[model samples]
Target: MQPDQEVPPRVRPGPLRWIAYAMGAGLPERHRTWVLYDTTTRTWVWRHVVRTFVQLAVPIALVLLLVPGAFWIRAMAALGGLILGMAFSLAYMTEAVENRVKKAGYAPGSAQAVRDLAGREREALDSERRRAAAAKRAVRYRDRRNR
Candidate 1:
Protein backbone atom coordinates (compact mmCIF):
# COMPACT_ATOMS: atom_id res chain seq x y z
CA MET A 1 0.00 0.00 0.00
CA GLN A 2 1.12 3.52 -0.67
CA PRO A 3 1.97 5.63 2.38
CA ASP A 4 -0.91 7.92 1.48
CA GLN A 5 -3.55 5.39 0.57
CA GLU A 6 -6.84 6.36 2.16
CA VAL A 7 -8.05 3.81 4.70
CA PRO A 8 -11.76 3.26 4.87
CA PRO A 9 -13.47 4.81 7.86
CA ARG A 10 -13.87 2.40 10.76
CA VAL A 11 -17.48 2.40 11.91
CA ARG A 12 -17.98 -0.23 14.58
CA PRO A 13 -21.31 -1.90 15.13
CA GLY A 14 -23.32 -1.32 18.29
CA PRO A 15 -23.51 -4.01 20.99
CA LEU A 16 -26.71 -5.53 19.63
CA ARG A 17 -25.35 -5.42 16.11
CA TRP A 18 -22.06 -6.92 17.23
CA ILE A 19 -23.85 -9.82 18.88
CA ALA A 20 -25.78 -10.41 15.72
CA TYR A 21 -22.60 -10.24 13.69
CA ALA A 22 -20.82 -12.68 15.99
CA MET A 23 -23.68 -15.06 15.30
CA GLY A 24 -23.02 -14.89 11.54
CA ALA A 25 -25.32 -12.05 10.60
CA GLY A 26 -24.01 -9.51 8.10
CA LEU A 27 -23.42 -6.02 9.39
CA PRO A 28 -24.95 -2.95 7.75
CA GLU A 29 -23.32 -1.35 4.73
CA ARG A 30 -21.96 1.53 6.80
CA HIS A 31 -19.81 -0.91 8.77
CA ARG A 32 -18.28 -2.60 5.74
CA THR A 33 -14.91 -0.95 6.27
CA TRP A 34 -14.86 -1.87 9.91
CA VAL A 35 -15.75 -5.40 8.96
CA LEU A 36 -12.73 -5.59 6.68
CA TYR A 37 -10.46 -3.94 9.22
CA ASP A 38 -11.72 -6.14 12.00
CA THR A 39 -10.97 -9.26 10.02
CA THR A 40 -7.49 -8.20 8.87
CA THR A 41 -6.04 -6.16 11.71
CA ARG A 42 -3.10 -7.26 13.91
CA THR A 43 -5.54 -8.36 16.61
CA TRP A 44 -7.82 -10.13 14.17
CA VAL A 45 -6.97 -13.56 15.49
CA TRP A 46 -7.79 -12.62 19.06
CA ARG A 47 -10.91 -10.90 17.84
CA HIS A 48 -12.02 -14.13 16.22
CA VAL A 49 -11.30 -16.05 19.38
CA VAL A 50 -13.53 -13.68 21.30
CA ARG A 51 -16.26 -14.03 18.74
CA THR A 52 -15.96 -17.80 18.85
CA PHE A 53 -16.33 -17.77 22.61
CA VAL A 54 -19.36 -15.55 22.30
CA GLN A 55 -20.88 -17.82 19.73
CA LEU A 56 -20.47 -20.78 22.02
CA ALA A 57 -21.47 -19.09 25.24
CA VAL A 58 -25.20 -19.71 25.12
CA PRO A 59 -24.89 -23.34 24.11
CA ILE A 60 -22.32 -24.03 26.78
CA ALA A 61 -24.54 -22.50 29.41
CA LEU A 62 -27.49 -24.49 28.21
CA VAL A 63 -25.52 -27.69 28.30
CA LEU A 64 -24.48 -27.04 31.85
CA LEU A 65 -27.97 -26.22 32.99
CA LEU A 66 -30.14 -28.66 31.05
CA VAL A 67 -27.99 -31.75 30.64
CA PRO A 68 -28.72 -34.58 33.08
CA GLY A 69 -25.55 -34.80 35.11
CA ALA A 70 -23.77 -33.59 38.24
CA PHE A 71 -22.60 -29.98 38.21
CA TRP A 72 -18.96 -30.95 37.94
CA ILE A 73 -19.69 -33.46 35.21
CA ARG A 74 -21.66 -30.91 33.23
CA ALA A 75 -18.85 -28.40 33.55
CA MET A 76 -16.27 -30.90 32.40
CA ALA A 77 -18.41 -31.82 29.40
CA ALA A 78 -18.91 -28.18 28.52
CA LEU A 79 -15.18 -27.59 28.77
CA GLY A 80 -14.44 -30.45 26.44
CA GLY A 81 -17.00 -29.21 23.95
CA LEU A 82 -15.59 -25.70 24.18
CA ILE A 83 -12.07 -26.93 23.53
CA LEU A 84 -13.14 -28.97 20.51
CA GLY A 85 -15.17 -26.09 19.14
CA MET A 86 -12.27 -23.70 19.53
CA ALA A 87 -9.90 -26.04 17.77
CA PHE A 88 -12.24 -26.46 14.80
CA SER A 89 -13.00 -22.76 14.72
CA LEU A 90 -9.33 -21.86 14.69
CA ALA A 91 -8.73 -24.18 11.79
CA TYR A 92 -11.19 -22.26 9.60
CA MET A 93 -10.82 -18.78 11.00
CA THR A 94 -9.51 -17.17 7.83
CA GLU A 95 -12.20 -18.70 5.70
CA ALA A 96 -14.81 -17.61 8.23
CA VAL A 97 -13.52 -14.02 8.16
CA GLU A 98 -13.52 -13.96 4.41
CA ASN A 99 -17.08 -15.23 4.37
CA ARG A 100 -17.92 -12.35 6.67
CA VAL A 101 -16.30 -9.85 4.30
CA LYS A 102 -18.21 -11.32 1.44
CA LYS A 103 -21.38 -11.21 3.45
CA ALA A 104 -20.70 -7.49 3.88
CA GLY A 105 -20.69 -7.28 0.06
CA TYR A 106 -16.96 -7.42 -0.67
CA ALA A 107 -15.51 -9.83 -3.22
CA PRO A 108 -13.90 -13.09 -2.25
CA GLY A 109 -10.32 -12.92 -0.91
CA SER A 110 -10.72 -9.25 0.06
CA ALA A 111 -9.67 -9.90 3.65
CA GLN A 112 -6.61 -11.83 2.55
CA ALA A 113 -5.66 -9.01 0.20
CA VAL A 114 -5.84 -6.45 2.97
CA ARG A 115 -3.80 -8.65 5.32
CA ASP A 116 -1.17 -9.22 2.62
CA LEU A 117 -0.82 -5.53 1.91
CA ALA A 118 -0.41 -4.74 5.59
CA GLY A 119 2.21 -7.47 5.93
CA ARG A 120 4.18 -6.17 2.94
CA GLU A 121 4.19 -2.64 4.31
CA ARG A 122 5.35 -3.88 7.70
CA GLU A 123 8.17 -5.90 6.12
CA ALA A 124 9.36 -2.92 4.11
CA LEU A 125 9.62 -0.76 7.19
CA ASP A 126 11.39 -3.51 9.11
CA SER A 127 13.88 -3.96 6.26
CA GLU A 128 14.70 -0.26 6.17
CA ARG A 129 15.30 -0.09 9.94
CA ARG A 130 17.39 -3.28 9.83
CA ARG A 131 19.59 -1.88 7.06
CA ALA A 132 20.23 1.36 8.98
CA ALA A 133 21.07 -0.55 12.18
CA ALA A 134 23.37 -2.94 10.31
CA ALA A 135 25.25 -0.04 8.72
CA LYS A 136 25.88 1.55 12.13
CA ARG A 137 27.07 -1.76 13.58
CA ALA A 138 29.42 -2.27 10.63
CA VAL A 139 31.03 1.14 11.13
CA ARG A 140 31.43 0.51 14.88
CA TYR A 141 32.98 -2.91 14.23
CA ARG A 142 35.48 -1.49 11.72
CA ASP A 143 36.63 1.24 14.15
CA ARG A 144 37.01 -1.23 17.05
CA ARG A 145 38.96 -3.71 14.89
CA ASN A 146 41.37 -0.98 13.68
CA ARG A 147 41.99 0.18 17.24
Candidate 2:
Protein backbone atom coordinates (compact mmCIF):
# COMPACT_ATOMS: atom_id res chain seq x y z
CA MET A 1 0.00 0.00 0.00
CA GLN A 2 1.08 3.57 -0.60
CA PRO A 3 2.44 5.56 2.37
CA ASP A 4 -0.40 8.04 2.05
CA GLN A 5 -2.93 5.21 2.28
CA GLU A 6 -2.73 4.27 5.90
CA VAL A 7 -3.78 0.80 7.03
CA PRO A 8 -5.82 0.35 10.17
CA PRO A 9 -4.11 -1.34 13.08
CA ARG A 10 -5.17 -4.82 14.14
CA VAL A 11 -6.52 -5.38 17.65
CA ARG A 12 -6.22 -8.69 19.48
CA PRO A 13 -9.46 -9.70 21.17
CA GLY A 14 -9.28 -12.20 24.04
CA PRO A 15 -9.72 -12.79 27.75
CA LEU A 16 -6.17 -11.76 28.67
CA ARG A 17 -6.47 -8.50 26.79
CA TRP A 18 -9.84 -7.85 28.40
CA ILE A 19 -8.42 -8.46 31.86
CA ALA A 20 -5.51 -6.15 31.19
CA TYR A 21 -7.83 -3.45 29.96
CA ALA A 22 -10.04 -3.86 33.06
CA MET A 23 -6.99 -3.29 35.24
CA GLY A 24 -6.40 0.03 33.39
CA ALA A 25 -3.65 -0.98 31.02
CA GLY A 26 -2.94 1.29 28.09
CA LEU A 27 -4.41 0.36 24.72
CA PRO A 28 -2.16 -0.90 21.95
CA GLU A 29 -1.80 1.09 18.76
CA ARG A 30 -4.04 -1.32 16.86
CA HIS A 31 -6.79 -0.82 19.42
CA ARG A 32 -6.53 2.96 19.17
CA THR A 33 -8.29 3.26 15.85
CA TRP A 34 -11.27 5.57 16.12
CA VAL A 35 -13.65 3.07 14.53
CA LEU A 36 -12.87 0.48 17.19
CA TYR A 37 -12.54 2.78 20.19
CA ASP A 38 -16.25 3.02 21.00
CA THR A 39 -16.81 -0.71 20.89
CA THR A 40 -13.67 -1.36 22.89
CA THR A 41 -14.72 1.12 25.57
CA ARG A 42 -18.15 -0.49 25.92
CA THR A 43 -16.65 -3.96 26.17
CA TRP A 44 -14.07 -2.83 28.70
CA VAL A 45 -16.73 -1.28 30.92
CA TRP A 46 -18.92 -4.36 30.76
CA ARG A 47 -15.97 -6.57 31.62
CA HIS A 48 -14.98 -4.31 34.49
CA VAL A 49 -18.51 -4.50 35.92
CA VAL A 50 -18.46 -8.27 35.76
CA ARG A 51 -14.99 -8.39 37.27
CA THR A 52 -16.01 -6.09 40.09
CA PHE A 53 -19.04 -8.21 40.90
CA VAL A 54 -17.00 -11.40 40.93
CA GLN A 55 -14.22 -9.81 42.95
CA LEU A 56 -16.61 -8.65 45.63
CA ALA A 57 -18.67 -11.81 45.71
CA VAL A 58 -15.93 -14.37 46.13
CA PRO A 59 -14.59 -13.27 49.49
CA ILE A 60 -18.04 -12.68 50.87
CA ALA A 61 -19.09 -16.13 49.76
CA LEU A 62 -16.02 -17.74 51.31
CA VAL A 63 -16.44 -15.93 54.60
CA LEU A 64 -20.11 -16.74 54.78
CA LEU A 65 -19.29 -20.38 54.05
CA LEU A 66 -16.85 -20.55 56.97
CA VAL A 67 -19.28 -18.98 59.41
CA PRO A 68 -22.04 -21.14 60.81
CA GLY A 69 -25.05 -19.11 59.90
CA ALA A 70 -28.74 -19.33 59.09
CA PHE A 71 -30.06 -19.07 55.55
CA TRP A 72 -31.04 -15.47 56.19
CA ILE A 73 -27.51 -14.66 57.26
CA ARG A 74 -26.03 -15.99 54.07
CA ALA A 75 -28.68 -14.22 52.07
CA MET A 76 -28.01 -10.97 53.83
CA ALA A 77 -24.30 -11.36 53.35
CA ALA A 78 -24.74 -11.85 49.63
CA LEU A 79 -27.10 -8.92 49.42
CA GLY A 80 -24.76 -6.67 51.37
CA GLY A 81 -21.84 -7.68 49.23
CA LEU A 82 -23.77 -6.91 46.11
CA ILE A 83 -24.84 -3.55 47.42
CA LEU A 84 -21.34 -2.65 48.55
CA GLY A 85 -19.83 -3.70 45.29
CA MET A 86 -22.40 -1.69 43.34
CA ALA A 87 -21.82 1.36 45.50
CA PHE A 88 -18.10 1.27 45.00
CA SER A 89 -18.51 0.74 41.30
CA LEU A 90 -20.89 3.66 41.05
CA ALA A 91 -18.50 5.85 43.01
CA TYR A 92 -15.69 5.06 40.63
CA MET A 93 -17.73 4.98 37.44
CA THR A 94 -16.29 8.23 36.20
CA GLU A 95 -12.77 7.04 36.74
CA ALA A 96 -13.56 3.78 35.03
CA VAL A 97 -15.00 5.57 32.01
CA GLU A 98 -12.03 7.88 31.83
CA ASN A 99 -9.66 4.96 32.10
CA ARG A 100 -11.39 3.26 29.23
CA VAL A 101 -11.12 6.43 27.16
CA LYS A 102 -7.45 6.72 27.93
CA LYS A 103 -6.89 3.07 27.18
CA ALA A 104 -8.53 3.66 23.85
CA GLY A 105 -5.74 6.19 23.11
CA TYR A 106 -7.65 9.34 23.98
CA ALA A 107 -6.95 11.96 26.60
CA PRO A 108 -9.07 11.96 29.76
CA GLY A 109 -10.41 15.37 28.74
CA SER A 110 -11.43 14.13 25.28
CA ALA A 111 -15.07 14.83 26.07
CA GLN A 112 -14.26 18.51 26.23
CA ALA A 113 -12.25 18.16 23.07
CA VAL A 114 -15.22 16.61 21.33
CA ARG A 115 -17.44 19.44 22.51
CA ASP A 116 -14.94 22.00 21.23
CA LEU A 117 -14.81 20.28 17.87
CA ALA A 118 -18.59 20.32 17.63
CA GLY A 119 -18.62 24.01 18.50
CA ARG A 120 -16.17 24.74 15.69
CA GLU A 121 -18.28 22.72 13.25
CA ARG A 122 -21.36 24.70 14.27
CA GLU A 123 -19.55 27.98 13.77
CA ALA A 124 -18.45 26.94 10.32
CA LEU A 125 -21.98 25.95 9.36
CA ASP A 126 -23.35 29.24 10.63
CA SER A 127 -20.77 31.15 8.61
CA GLU A 128 -21.71 29.23 5.51
CA ARG A 129 -25.40 30.02 6.04
CA ARG A 130 -24.70 33.72 6.46
CA ARG A 131 -22.59 33.77 3.33
CA ALA A 132 -25.35 32.07 1.38
CA ALA A 133 -27.93 34.58 2.63
CA ALA A 134 -25.71 37.51 1.72
CA ALA A 135 -25.13 36.12 -1.76
CA LYS A 136 -28.90 35.76 -2.29
CA ARG A 137 -29.47 39.34 -1.18
CA ALA A 138 -26.77 40.57 -3.54
CA VAL A 139 -28.37 38.74 -6.44
CA ARG A 140 -31.79 40.14 -5.59
CA TYR A 141 -30.38 43.71 -5.46
CA ARG A 142 -28.68 43.30 -8.81
CA ASP A 143 -31.87 41.96 -10.43
CA ARG A 144 -33.97 44.89 -9.14
CA ARG A 145 -31.46 47.47 -10.38
CA ASN A 146 -31.37 45.90 -13.87
CA ARG A 147 -35.20 45.98 -14.12
The numbered model that scores best in lDDT is 1
lDDT per residue as tens, model 1, 1-147: 478998678899999999999999998888998998899999999999999999999999999999997999999999999999999999999999999999998899999998999999999999999999999999999999999
Clashes of each: 0, 0
Over the stretch 37-139, how does candidate 2's per-residue lDDT look in tens digits?
A: 4434435456557767755766677757876779788878878878887889878865666666666766776644554576688899999999999999999
lDDT of 1: 0.95
Model 2 quality (TM-score): 0.48
By TM-score, the best candidate is: 1
> What lDDT does the true structure give each of the candidates?
0.95, 0.67
Off by over 4 Å in 1: 1-8
Instruction: Look at candidate 1 and tell me the lDDT of residue 80.
Output: 98
Cα-based lDDT at residue 22, candidate 1: 95
